[model samples]
Target: MTNERRVLVHPDADALVAAVSARFLTKLTDLLDEHHEANVVLTGGTLGEAVQKAVATSPMRSAIDWTRVHFWWGDERFVPKDDPDRNEVQAREALLQHLPTAEDHIHPFPASDEIEDIDAAAEAYAQELRDHADPALRLPVPRFDITFLGVGPDGHIASLFPEHGVTRDGQDLVVSDEDSPKPPPRRLSLTLPVINSSQRIWMVLAGTEKASALGLALAGASPEEVPVAGAEGRLRTVFFIDGDAASHVPADLIASQY
Candidate 1:
């Protein structure tokens, strides 16, 4: 069964970063303790990098056996591996490289330089998911303990843009977007189904510019019109926003504690 969505508003961007970082550490430890292994799907953006950097400096970061954890990307720009625009590049500089995480355990999408094209790269990632799928998940993916997503002001999540029909239909675990409304044009992203398959989905957003998108998502907007609205987790779904982003969110939807 799917779970209802919840909203958590932080005082500001800085508070959002600290709160999320702390919550991440706690969730990681809990998942590791309960399952012995944890798979995390990470996002990329200024905020995403900020959270990673915060986790790197966190006092509780060392408590976990990083080797037991597997890190995955929710989506990636199809760029050269060494390109500064690549999410993995910023992520490594911010956190993953600092952890003792096993090299084989970090699953980044195939870079443009490493593969033929976006389609090939997308399939490569899909195969990687299949390779890591747990039998019990009953899906062609791993047991994603937590999937972190950064919502665009336009309400897109991952590379699933609302402008295109990218969020509409696909059983493929991963899909390639060759003409993204945003930069770089090409990208690879996990489908909404794959994202929703996770145990928990954390949608992180900030800034007053995101207020409309947040309000629409919570107002039951169609996925095709607001992709973020369609994203949910089997166990839990949460919208973690800052005061600025929550400007249009209803008072009742805002949880004082989560």
Candidate 2:
């Protein structure tokens, strides 16, 4: 069974950050208590980095067993590993640097500079996931415990842009995107099939410029029109939005309760 999409609106960016941080800690604690290991797929963007900062600043940060948490990227900028624009670099500055996780547990996509071939690098990442699968389990693929994603003002998520082939296919995972609307133009994104396999998924939006896209997604736009509409999770799917971002969503409906 799949969970219905739900939204949580906050008064401002600060409040949104707090809500995301609190929920993140709660989810991490609950997952840790219920299972010995947890897999987290993280997104990259201003809001995504803010959530990381909030986690780092939260008092309950220490409660998580970082060693048992496997971190993965939802999508990354096709740049050099050390580039300031790289998602991994920003993520490290915000939270990963403060966490006690072993360096090996942090899984970042290959750098465009080092790999030379973007498609090959993406294929390697897919292979890594396959290699990590539990031998005893006959599941089609390894599933993540949680996946944190952020939507673009254009409504794309995890590099799955509107009308893109990757957004329409039901592949387990994708190794390359040929026509990304976003800059850098190329990326590897988890397909809808893989994204929906997660136990939980959270979509966070913060800027006022994102309001229109948020409204469309909550109103059930087609994935080809707004890729964010494709977001789904087997257990839960949540939308975390600040006031500026939620302003366009109908007041009588979703955001009012929050």
* Best TM-score among the predictions, by candidate number: 1
Clashes per prediction?
0, 0
lDDT of 1 by residue, 221-254 (tens): 9988899988889898989899999889999998
Global CA lDDT of candidate 1, please?
0.91
Quote the positional error of residue 52 for candidate 2 in Å: 0.5
My TM-score estimates for the predictions, one after another, are 0.97, 0.91
The residue pairs that clash in candidate 2, if any, are: none
Whole-model Cα lDDT per candidate? 0.91, 0.81
**Runs in model 2 with CA error above 4 Å?**
134-140, 251-258
